[model samples]
Target: MLYDLFLKPYEGYSTLFIVLEAIAAFFGIVSVWFARRNSIWVYPTGIISTVLYVYVLFVSGVYGDAVINIYYTAMSLYGWYVWLNVKGEGQALPITWLHRRSALFTGGFTLANFALFYIILQYYTDSIVPTLDAITTALAFSAMYLMARKKVESWAFWIACDVISVGLYIYKGLGVTALQYLIFLILAISAHFEWVRLYREQQAAQAHPGNTTTKPA
Candidate 1:
């Protein structure tokens, strides 16, 4: 049953492609795990994963996702820089809630991305699942941006994108990738709550700086 579900889809595919997917999936999971812990390593691990998936998705004819991975690679670099340089002295960037204005901007940006990719996929590419691809790609783009900004809402976008991508990859005969997205869905949900808690802790720390353990007795 396991073989039928996972390996069967790759019966005629090259072993190299299958191995690549597995490796990419591994790094992707590690990246998300780092993000959950609010660690700086997330960007580096995510860069590796996204770079691999850019090639994987392009070869598989998922042009929108290929583009998303390219964007992810570029954004990962920017995010890494922001995380390192924008911190307060020795502290990391504080996880925060998205502002109302930022939320509205993200919604508009996602919709625009969807329309743009849909048009390109429908006209320029021979993509079979243009709508699904565009939707997931757009959602992921917003998620990546918000994540780099250290907003808690980024996980929400990732949750939605992962849910759609799980089915999308299944339909595309990428069983391993489909499984990866399912795992991503779970991790995103967990990360949302974790980030929320972390945000609250940040607020508490700001409110009670004197209560820190570093305070002299």
Candidate 2:
């Protein structure tokens, strides 16, 4: 049973996939670690992971995931530049919450993307789990966009996406990637709290601008 749950999936796959997935997972963890610290290294490391996954997911026949990885790669580059310019001297980009209007737009966009992808994947491709794939892909799109903007709510989307992805990847017989998502879920939860703390600190600093001792950024 254990073999079936784990090793059985690797039976016909190339050793290249195992190696690629492991490397991607390692860099993915590193990227999240940098993100938690609000470091600029996050985008570089994330680009590596997402680039590899683009190939992996494409070969695995998960087209939605493949496309999202491509999007991630592009976003990582954009984010790298944004983060570099957004920070002032001795400060990181301020973590922020989404406005209600922005939140509504994001939510609507995710749903629309999901619906469109579901229809395309279901009708145009031979994808095994089109609905789940579409759902995860849509969530990831919103999460990645928010993360690039240094929004605290991005972690919430990531936490949700990571949890669903664990089951999704496992069902797709990619146990290693599934385990990676499990780790991602934990990191996303930790990041959520950390970002919230940072946001609070930033808020307090703004309220007490005269206090030079408060290191909000």
Candidate 2, residues 116-173, lDDT tens digits: the string is 9999999999999999899999999999999989899899889988988999998988
TM-score of 1: 0.94
| Residue-by-residue lDDT tens digits, candidate 1, 78-102 | 8888777643444666678888998
Point to the candidate with the largest lDDT: 1
Q: In candidate 1, which residue pairs clash?
A: none
**TM-score of every candidate:** 0.94, 0.93
10 residues in a row with least lDDT, candidate 1: 208-217
How does candidate 2 fare on TM-score? Answer: 0.93
lDDT of each: 0.87, 0.87
